[model samples]
Target chain A: MAKPLILVTNDDGITAPGVRTLIHIMKKIGDVIVVAPDSPQSGMGHAITLDSTLYAEKLTIDEESEGIVEYSCSGTPADCVKLALQELMERKPDICVSGINHGSNSSINVIYSGTMSAAIEAGIEGIPAIGFSLCDYKWEADFSQAKEYVQTIVEQALQHGIPKGTVLNVNIPKLTKDELKGIKVCRQARANWKEKFDKRKNPMGKDYYWLTGEFELLDQGEDTDEWALANGYISVVPTQFDLTAHHAVQELNSWNF
Target chain B: MAKPLILVTNDDGITAPGVRTLIHIMKKIGDVIVVAPDSPQSGMGHAITLDSTLYAEKLTIDEESEGIVEYSCSGTPADCVKLALQELMERKPDICVSGINHGSNSSINVIYSGTMSAAIEAGIEGIPAIGFSLCDYKWEADFSQAKEYVQTIVEQALQHGIPKGTVLNVNIPKLTKDELKGIKVCRQARANWKEKFDKRKNPMGKDYYWLTGEFELLDQGEDTDEWALANGYISVVPTQFDLTAHHAVQELNSWNF
Candidate 1:
């Protein structure tokens, strides 16, 4: 049997520890190809470069990465996937995996996530996809602890293709492999950010602000992704790109326009 | 009764003709305050400025905008909403309206729309919101045809209040008011872009690419937003920021991971 081809990408730049670990893990399962942003695209959602030009350069990141194909792209996470599927790759990949991100993308973060955007982009193209993230946000955070679990999930996804019209958003808790219980499938938790912009002045007396926030959890559901991650389990949320609220369509139809 | 305070924004920047026209119409319905990006932010899906500082200036675009408070912010559409809700506005707005966008955000385009991002951001903040877009992509696109329909929807939304956990995404076809049919409550059409990157070389022999795509509609459903727009009717899809695929949860749970 021919080896299944896997496309690897992330919101963090290709040099980030998180994606480097992801590329290493994916290589064990199938033929590996990496096309990711040259800079971090943390909260870029599903953004694509329309008004600007994109550059993709093939490079060797390390001595061990000589045989693996990697392209550092000057675009968002979504743009990397689009360029790869449309132009870079010779044939369609069996699956696309994004992240092993430097931070959590659980609950409400999924909407603002560049990590999940790449996975969602591949899912839209009818390829099985998954986005993995660690609960830690530090650049030097431990990713070695997630190797076995990440590999298992990727193997399973390739074995049983993800359901159509959806991608997997996987978030791992900041716990040792021994302390980490296992994986659980859950729905996204309802939440929002309490944003506060830090106001400052420039030398010219111009007002500038830096955005900061605290995550506010609004749901108490045990079946939510938040609950799973909080309980030391890897949370796999089946995420979709379809923006429609199917349940509300009926009620809205009765209204006169 | 006191007039409702309406917040207006768009991805096409604060001064685009589409948003300018939106401000004029919204002013008639309520007290209008505008907070939009300082430059065009097309295809900027849900992006928020995290690693940089943002500058928001209280600017008056013209003499006609004297009394109405408007701020031009150096950020994405979602960032503008966050700034307005968190810092700029003195009080919580009654409703948030985005766009009268210059192009179609009818189906798959919704996932990549900065217009809808502002509305979704407001929705996450527990505010009733709606995003409006014209199927025409011209800067000088005739927005006069959408005046009556836009006002009716906004008024209806304020009176009835949108359902909890949802925002409205309305797309108007490129047609005169006479040729335009009425509004229709619809689901987002299932579609994808057949993206092709135009590759070229620079003087230094380095390659740069321009991204372009053609919309490919795959659904035959008559109740979709694409169907509505094609039939000369305005389409209103109840959009949600929650990315969870509820139906696929049970299936994923059965997987061994």
Candidate 2:
């Protein structure tokens, strides 16, 4: 049988070490074609470059890698998926995987995540997709700890297809291989950021400030992704792109619009 | 009873006429406080400024608008809401409304909309919220047609709050007052963009590309936001921030993670 075609992408740009690690893992399962942002697109969420133009070019970072085609995109991560599906690939990939991002995209952050947006874009197109993230925010975090675990999950996914209208958001804790426990399928933990801006003046004596915030976890449930990550286990949360509140629909209908 | 407090925000920068119009309309039904992005943050989605410092300051557009306080934040629309709740506002507003944006955020765009993100941010904080958009993408788009309709809807909302965990996403058609039809509450249409990248060469003889896309409407249902807007009727779709696919939970539970 022909190898499963896998589309790989990341919000951390094509040159990031995170995608390189993801590429190494995806290569063991299928033919890989990478289309990722040319620069870091953290916090971009599902932004597409409608007001601006986008560019894509084929490149080879490491020549020794085989059968892995890659293109760096001058657009957001979501734009890369659209370009790959529309213009780059001849046949649709069997699966699409985004990231192994430097920071976590679990819970509420998923809505603001470029990595998960790539996966959601694939799921919208009826393709099975997954997003991987590491809890550590450092550029050169140790992803070797998650190497075997990610490979196992991706292999299992390729062998057994995911359900319709659903994609996976997988986040791994920053732990050594020996300290790492097994994977846990869990729900997104309810969490939010406490925002505070650092006000400052520019060189021109004009007030110009920067945006900053800190994560604040509110949910303490054991079945949450936050709990799993805290317990040294890899967290796998099934994510959906449909923003419709099906449960709230009836209650909303009760209102006189 | 005192008038309901309505928090207003947008991604098209704090100075955009679209948000000004929203403030005007919302003020008639409720006390208004504007907390918006300092610069244009289109397509930011639910992005929060976690890695960087944020700033916000009391803005005084004019002395005539005295009772209504305004603050412009140096962050995404979501960050604006977070700051408003955490460090800016003394207490949670009764309702939150984002945009009267300069473009359409009707279908799949909602997932990537900074306008909707502000409203969703407010919703997650348990505040009733709504995101308003116009089909016109022009800076000088005629908003007179939507004034009466928008006011009516906001007044209705003030009288009867939206359901918990849900926010209204309203899209107005760009038509004259006479041509404008009444409001029609609807569901989000299943739609997507067909992306096209224009490849070109930069100054240094390096290739760069621009991202562009045309909207593709997959669902032709009459009770959809796209259809309503096309027919000159205001579209109101109840949107939710919960990214969880509860139906898929049982199915995923069977998977060997």
Candidate 3:
């Protein structure tokens, strides 16, 4: 049987330590191909390059390791998936995974996440996909502690394919392997960031602002992704791309058009 | 009674004819504040700025339009709404309006629209929001035909608030006022764009690709955005920020943790 072909991409630039760790771990499981943003696309949600052109380049970072087929793209995470499947990859990947991102994409933040967008893009194309993120935001954040858990989850997901119209949003708590609790399959927590801007002036003495926010978790449920991460466990929330409000449809149906 | 404060934003940049038209319509109804992107964001989706600092400045294209606060943001449409609500606006806006976008953001494109993202951001803030789009894609697309319909809809929306957790995804047909029918409240049409990449070599002999697609409608029902737009009627699909597949939730609940 042919080894499972795995496609890996991330919102962080191709050289980020996070994707490097993902590439190493994925090699142990299957044939891995890396197609990722040329620059950081952290909050780029489901954006695709429609109005502009996209550039891609084949690159080699190391000769010591079994060379992973890699391409750095000048597009959003979703664009990378489209390019990989449409232009680069010779065969469709058996499994597509995004991230091992340096920050969490759980709950409401998922709606503004580039990491999850890649996973969603793959899922839209009928491929089983997963997006993994660590709660830490530091550039040199430790990803090794989450590696073993990631391998276990990816192996299981590939073995038992994900359900149609669904992709996994796997967020690992930033903790040592021994300190980490086992994985918990959970639902997305109802939460949103309370946005607060940091207002400042530029060198020209003109007013400018930086978008910053404080995370405010309104939901106190124990089954939420926030709760799981808080308790030092990995959370796997099954996310879907359809934005339809099925329940609201009934109410909307009653409205006079 | 205090006049309702209308916050206007769009992905097509501050100078797009679509947004200028929106600004005009909104100004007539209420005190309008325009917080929009500095450059066209088109398919930028729900992206936010995280890796780099954001810059927003008070903009004045004409002295005639005074006292109405306007800011040009250096981020995605989602970032614009977040900034507007957090820093620019003195108080919570009564309503948020995004777009009169140059191209269609109906159906599946809603998942990949920066215009709709602005509306969704406003919805998350518990503010009534709507994103308007024109079926035409030209830079000079005439939005005059949409004025009366848009004004009526906005007036109605302000009079009767949108249901909680919902925003309006409104797409108008590109037609003269005489040619257009009335508005149709509908559901998102099940549709997708079959992507085609034009791969080419640059002067440096490096490969680059342009993203293009032909939209394919899979739904034949008249109660859909595509159907409404095709029939020369304004389409309003009440959208929601909660992306949970509630039906799948039951099956997911049955899964072993």
Ranking by DockQ: 1, 3, 2
DockQ of each: 0.90, 0.53, 0.55
Please write out the lDDT profile of model 1 over residues B1-257, one tens digit for every residue.
Answer: 78999999999998999999999999899999999999999999989998999999998887767799999999999999999998999999999999989999989999999999999999999999999999999999999988988999999998889988999999999998899989999999999999999999988999999999889999999999999999999999999888899999989878887
> If both were scored by lDDT, which would come out higher, candidate 1 or candidate 3?
1
Q: What is the C-alpha RMSD of each candidate to the true structure, in Å?
A: 0.8, 2.6, 2.1
By summed lDDT, which 10 consecutive residues of candidate 1 chain B come out lowest?
B59-68
> How would you encode candidate 2's per-residue C-alpha lDDT over A138-235 as one tens digit per residue?
99898888999998888878777887778999999989999888898888898876665676777766665456668899888998899999999998
Better of 1 and 3 by DockQ: 1
Best by TM-score: 1
Model 1 residue B25 lDDT score = 92
TM-score of chain B of 1: 0.99
Q: Per-model C-alpha lDDT, please?
A: 0.94, 0.84, 0.87
Worst 10 residues of 2 chain A by lDDT: A248-257
- Residues A47-154 of candidate 3 have per-residue lDDT tens digits of 898867899888875553357899999999999999999899999999999988989988898898899999988988889999999999988999999888889888
Please report the TM-score between candidate 3 and the true structure.
0.94
Count clashes in each candidate, considering only residues at least 3 apart in sequence or on different chains.
0, 15, 0
Model 3, runs deviating above 4 Å: A63-65, A253-257, B62-67, B250-257
Q: Candidate 1, DockQ to 2 decimals?
A: 0.90
